[model samples]
Target: MQQKISDQLSTTAERPSGRQASSPRAVPVLTLVSHPQPQRIGERLLLETLANTGRTASLSRSAPEFSRPGLPPGQPLADPFLSRTPVQFAPGTRGRLRLLVPKDGTPVRVAEEPARGAREFLPEELIAGVPLVLAERVVLLLHLTRVPEAPVTQELGMVGQSESLRRVREDISRVADLDVPVLIRGETGTGKELVARAIHQQSPRREGPFISINLSAIPRELAASELFGVQRGAYTNAIQDRLGLFRAAQGGTLFLDEVGEAPPEVQVALLRVLETREVYPVGGNTPVPVDVRLLTATDANLEERIQRELFRAPLLHRLAGFEIRMPPLRERREDIGPLFLHFARQELEAIGEAHRLTVTDPRAEPWLPAALAVRLLRYAWPGNVRQLRNITRQLIIGSRGLPHLRIGDRLEQELTVDPQSAGSPHISGFEDTADPDELSPSRRRPADVGEQELLQALRASAWDLKATSERLSISRASVYLLIDKSSLLRTAGNLSPEEITRCFHECQGNLDKMVQRLEVSRRALQRRVRELGLGGP
Candidate 1:
């Protein structure tokens, strides 16, 4: 057998502080999304600090070695199909990375596009995560891990390592023990209730029952009585005296979800409870003193509601004593793999299909393909964590008794389609073009999309040029034209050779600077420079 040839990216050097470093201070990391070898799933490789500008790092078949998180440094990824040649990474000016892939090396795809020659990735792109497919079998995500959020000792019952989640956890730790009304804010399905639960679990009221109520789900007439206690015959069907959510959660916590949806009467009643620390039961004059702590959550715009007078100003001030924002699933994408696995394990165990994740055959294809995983990572996740959890459940249950997890029409719809319902999936956006290599900018339907929808798709696709095309139902060339037309995006291809050459020297030949100034793709600009016969910095 050939010797165990170990290959890895060089250790990166420490970076300077502030935006000079990574603005928010982040380091690049490589996570194995999945491989045909199921054991490689979720393994991580932390690309270390590059000591200086000139020094660089690399990745080949054997690159992610013993230094791989949770693995011994001496042990390399023993995949037999990977190429010996490496894809290189070097620090660019201002916290960006210059990437190079050899033409002769194993085939590589960046964001599902062929990765040939050179490219550059901004720090923001790293944060959003850059997906790489190697040799068509291995998938790795290059993303940023902001400093200080590098894994803590306790799990805190949360399943992600993203920086946003770390901040949310920190808020919980700081405000949990304090006696205050905690308000959790975020979009729907972003897990506002989870944040509420975490606070309650960590607070002094942990021992007491945690009562939860959804104000939006309750009828307006019953809302007040439901929140406060209802005395016998308070209204029809009010059988006996009832203890309200506040009294039921005595010495514990009362979680008011969808608090923005609280009826006008309920809002007034709630503000009084916050002021008096007691409730006024319906059909009674006596005030019932309650020791419950309040934790309310909302996806609605409470301030807007206040502007419209649908919600009371006093109530808004009362609920937001301490605010904790639950990040949407798209914002905390790095946690998706862990969160998916957490959900998958639960569902698999529930149906006695835990073994489904691991196929014994060495030659079998991975049930969860890298393409699917990358799609999951790149998806807008409009439904947030709840959406992802539901998708995970669907992927597992819908594939029952199958060798691989089946992505049904419904599951695929949930996975690939956007919130605006971009409609059905086509065979390929690249199809129907006469030139094949290039589609005209003046093509039909490309100009029909307005600026806002175009911008929306661009953001939703994380500025991926190809992805934006798919989202807009247009060709790549048309997408570029639309981008060039918009003030938001420009292409180096649009700039003249002379203009690029002049800027190249003005920036002291720093491609990163040129990228910032030219407002063009760094890779595209780099290529243009080479085409112009201007050299690298």
Candidate 2:
């Protein structure tokens, strides 16, 4: 299993020199477990076909080690290129792979050979104790010449192309050469983890482990042990000594996610870890030395918490060595398309599905109808990248069942509206009683709105989230949530400026007609009109 993984590391012909440092020896081993083959009849034939062809085409080869100039004639390269080891499955060796099905029940292999080019493919079925056959003559590529460039960026699948993202990337590039702690702030689902990964991937420590710890995921009692390591018999339930994230990430990067959720006691330990490159594990007498680049992220406003004395101000100061604030999805409309494509491609590849419509392909652009685009643009994605990924997954799964046109329309409709029942009050708590002029018609704060307009745009676009989002110049997912939070539809006696103006004009300034349309008492309408600067002057 380890050998299979090692071979796959350098299989890709054009990975960047930095990212290609060393592919995980655990990849192939994990892939077999994660993507298991079907267990139906003819599984053996499918496995054989894959073992003969598919895996080879998917492999990436590492680049040759380059020697620096002025080196002695016979000096070796700084980093020696790892040689590929020959892999022999041995006849009748079992394997497993995910079976492709035109429909749900019938399964077929997308590609036949599961391994090739000095690499072995572990079929999922063999891992599951099922017997399988391996191809006798599985020809392999030994060592291929390096290519000009890698086709994909190491950060390819991450979402967002907004100015905010670009700026964040710039910050990361700038910080790569330094050893300062970084604090990433964003709302939930804003891809804080991705930002941390990008920083680590681009830094000099790229070759080392990029360890992450979710402060919220660990229990308060165990937080100390998890972050600072624990000795055997440290306390009750201490079965063995354990190396914590800090030690595991020595000479690399350590990312603390949801740092605000950490308890006060743990915060002190973390501060000490940051100040001094030392850690005192539970039940240990002396502190161990550690060298790690620190990265922290939080959805909550740590500053506000600090002001309220909920969080230690000194700790906050320590973590904010460099801060990068991310804008919500609604704030950056231009990045929607690129983000959509990024997630779409990742989902398809993960599930072993063909490209329904590849991004960057002009032909595929036409397939993503203008209406769909508008829907996507108009809606606001409160859940941000995560919601978008989930929606894209649904679209892929749904496309398999319905007609292409219907599927697109269904997607459009869902994207625009609430995806629940039609006529769900657009937003709640927005009453018609307020004066029309009180709500400025001009775009005072384009980035901040109560959410009604976003939902209306969503419903108007037939729940085609992308199209609705575009029409409103926001993210589709955001529109859906805003409608729920704003309570626009459920609110009673609420009137928009346009609705009041239209009714007043149609009524020819008649109080009765305007009152009926506006759904307010005559006295209330008069007061509103006066407040709106529309009453007799």
Candidate 3:
């Protein structure tokens, strides 16, 4: 009677969330590839939804233990490789196996019990592999066939597989077909120009030239002539007729970077161009027609600048026909590892070396250790993707040809020196160690060096790490490590939740200003805001 009841329950639960069950005679088999661990792999598996509740089952050749926490009762466990072990499944046992396999072109086979027949599973099947329901309970982690790697594109130089990145790509594709202006807002180093280029490349204007100009780089006096072609003798030093960015990008796209930096006069000219699709060159009477699509990028809060009357409100409305915000590196931490690998490969290829270095290789260089990747993911990366790429290049070049390398050891040596010795000898805490003759007679370090002194230096340098490091005569890494250890990077004083909220509001939700005012690290301020339930901008 008990056996019958058990069988009935299994049958009732056999029906999946919505789909019909597979043939009863044909057991569901999942063959997972062995290379690129599942945690790091990005391939989507069939019937993955069914395994949502399934837990990883520990399996090994020795001792073959089956009874464990979360294990389904009365499910037959079998070792596919062990001939003596019989594989049995309860009437409605549903199971899914996650296997790791190699990417090299090779076939994988698993032996079946009783019949003792070996079945081969192809790579394509594993790539779009589906999970099976053997019984109500039964999930296995098996070693099986490998899945082929997903193809990567070098176009736009955007590297990431996270959902955030996918959405950005989708946004770029959707907007590429249109001629409307686009406004891209992102933190520094987030690749706004690359995104603009991608849109241009995908647009109907791909045959036309794409021109980019940094509004901040041009002098306020020459902004108009620089953007719109100038007539000869327009002004002093206007010796030749010059085609400006607007005319140069005539049929294509014009990418204006740091658009927020445009002067008020330049802003008015931009608004006119957008409104009339025409530009007036400096000292030129006729309006030159321009058919260029405009794409603008900025790291600043243009809305705040407008509120302060530093930017024109009308221009903002015209420029932002479509807006896309690129997420910072900290928000898409999962992409860091892959991006590091991508940058490393690019660097190696550019240097005319083999670009086959694998992160999984046990013999990989120390500076490129998997742990460093984890640390990088945790870092705030204030400078974002550009900083990561620069750091990767530095590490690769620094550690090249070294038989062994350990990042932790090097960082410790650089960061663990006596606090006083880390700064200049003229500082109060530091004792003069260098030769007197080597030191300039007129130059002197600060008489007092402490947390207060460091904070002052940081303020004076506008929180520039390199400048702060130079002021203290310490390595940049040491400065970072010291700042982190002493908690000097945190907001200076403890404030009530209300006070913190007030400060955040006062800063117009600008986290950078909040950091500066509070003398805290950006991460610290972000955390405080979260704890106080003060949502960020």
Candidate 4:
């Protein structure tokens, strides 16, 4: 057995050394070839290769791209991969396999054959949940026979390179290999679902179904049936038996978006499934066996909901096995330019507007000016990426011939209406003030009044720290502290973990608020929350 395994390894040569040869060479019993219509043609050749050699084979194709749907008008549609697929020759394929996109006309070689009786293969990277096993196998084969010179493009569409985004990517990379539930916390237009997709793409279960169910979008009456399946005769509208998100994602991922909106009963049912790895269909007698990696996301605070008895504690715990917080776009000001440029380039390419031009003229992309970038960085992005992309497209189309000059004017108009700035109320020379309530007999100073007014402003703004800070001409951190030191802490809700989180959120995550609202010092509050496994798990 050992000799046979060794012989197989020698024939396969699984690992490639640096800089493979450009030309295809024939071995004693096998040969590799390059095909022009690689994506479509390579699969057939791979079968031929494996049939002739009784060994593993692979096929390769050139990088492909396709325009993404659901983009707003005038916005550039993202194209991740247009054309390219892989074929792996194995007796029976099972488990996860990596997919690679190769440069044009690369030769594909066979390294290993599939194990017999293998029923399915998990793709290493996901393109809409379709396995790239055969396509990737081909690319691997080609790389072994002859390495390509150019680097491959791994993604199709989207923009922004903020540090917050980089951190998100790093976290996804770290957690993708594990089966832990991931909780993505972010506002609308923050791309929570996109992050989930990225996680699925980089995970071992990439080839299986990546099913998405918006917990908030589904009607209350239908949610249970939709999420947990239903018997054919379970309800008045039931015509046939159905599989739920759990079954759909049996070997892959189930993305539960707007998870905070799940009704209390649904939360309990979800918790049961999370803890048991099983689900009982609505009105069904038997429990369905399931294997799923749960990925949940929400903009609302589950902790607050739990406090209000609107969410289940156990469900929240199960969903938050790991947590990722998405920072709003305004906070990552540096990404504005790159994001704009990316959007503009995509739009120009998609419309074939620049078909005759090799390089885009700087003047044509007026929103890319250095001065405009500075202004964009200053204005807090209320709607995040989606908003920015829309504004960019608007600028591009609205400014027509005088793109540069018009972009500047449009940018100025945007700055004027920026909710962050225009929303603030001026306080003269408040920087020179101190904690002077100590000297006054009433134990209050003009500063105290100012602080209270700020808190009221924040409350009126619906606890939006950015708008509050902009209106007060102060930093968000300072406003966070000021709200706690003011009167808001006295009226905090009950002492549940969720309530504690709500109070802290209302306080903009200020340490002072945790101390005052919870009637505990900063350290104690932190320790208690951690001990209870509250907030972030």
Q: How many backbone clashes does candidate 2 have?
A: 75
Q: Which candidate is the best by lDDT?
A: 1
Considering TM-score, where higher is better, how would the candidates rank from best to worst?
A: 1, 3, 4, 2
**Worst window of 10 by summed lDDT in candidate 2:** 33-42
The TM-score of predicted model 3 comes to 0.54
Instruction: Report every candidate's CA lDDT.
Output: 0.70, 0.51, 0.55, 0.51
**lDDT by residue (tens digit), candidate 3, 288-373:** 89999999999888988988999998999999999988876744544565676667667777776533454343222233332343
Preferred candidate (TM-score higher): 1 or 3 = 1
Report the Cα lDDT for residue 224, model 2. 89
lDDT of 3 at 334: 43
At residue 446, give the lDDT of candidate 3.
29
Error of 1 at 46 (Å): 2.0
Clashes of 1: 10
TM-score of 1: 0.72
Off by over 4 Å in 2: 1-160, 349-355, 358-366, 401-537
| Lowest lDDT block of 10, candidate 1 | 422-431
Error of 4 at 93 (Å): 66
Superposed Cα deviation of residue 73, candidate 3 (Å): 29
